[model samples]
Target: MNALFFVMGCVDGRLVLTLEETADMLGMALQTAYNQIDAGTFPIPLRKNGRKWVADARDIAEYLDLMRKEAREAHDALKRKLAA
Candidate 1:
């Protein structure tokens, strides 16, 4: 997970990330992020707060962790295959 996300302030007792922050975390354009949200294809769930979309910080962190674990496992499998 990104260190920037960890330092984000909380809103209403929950650590939530703005749409821009979520886009940055995912390395996508702001417009792309909006499109993904509308299409319901974003990896992390989001909800509209007033006029903007926000995602739970914990959810983003968990998704990142899961992606990292999967990538590491795939790399290890490839290495084992090559060694054999």
Candidate 2:
């Protein structure tokens, strides 16, 4: 019954991060995140859980971290090219 406990990985169960959190973490729009889910690029979420889209928190965090690292590297390369 305690949603807050889920955020800290305290519950002995799977945690679902909201689409908004996922989007914010990836620095992307809500639609873009939905598209990835729709296109099967991102992990599919659980269904109709009373009104919220439910995705594994671990998956969302991992995907965002990976994408963030890649984006930063790409930006660095572009900066180097411009500086050269």
Candidate 3:
């Protein structure tokens, strides 16, 4: 819908994303995104351009795949715990 289009526009044909756009895409607060970047635990590697942080779409996709795997593992673990 309209929301989807808005999110898509956040990244251009170059696949570049600003810190705020990346935070919005990741569903986290802007401050939290900065913290994660500082801690080096963000979903993907970001490049610093002056005072802003930038992310690539390919990296974000990879991060999503990694998160999906972790989620599946956690779900399986919870099911086992409940069965026991």
Each model's C-alpha lDDT?
0.77, 0.62, 0.75
- Give the alpha carbon lDDT tens digit for every residue of 6-84 in model 1: 5354333358889888778767899998788779788888889999888887777787778778999999999999999
Q: How good is model 1 by TM-score?
A: 0.80
Of models 1 and 3, which has the larger TM-score? 1
Residue-level lDDT tens digits of model 2 in 11-77: 3444766677656645688898788878877553434467766666666555556666889999999
Candidate 1 yields a Cα-based lDDT of 0.77
What residue pairs are clashing in model 2?
Answer: none
Worst 10 residues of 3 by lDDT: 1-10
Top candidate on TM-score is 1
* Pairs of colliding residues, candidate 1: none
Q: Write the per-residue lDDT of candidate 3 for residues 1-84, one digit (tens) a residue.
A: 223344455565457778787788778999998888788887768898898888876666666666768899999999999999
lDDT of 2 at 3: 30
**Strongest candidate by lDDT:** 1
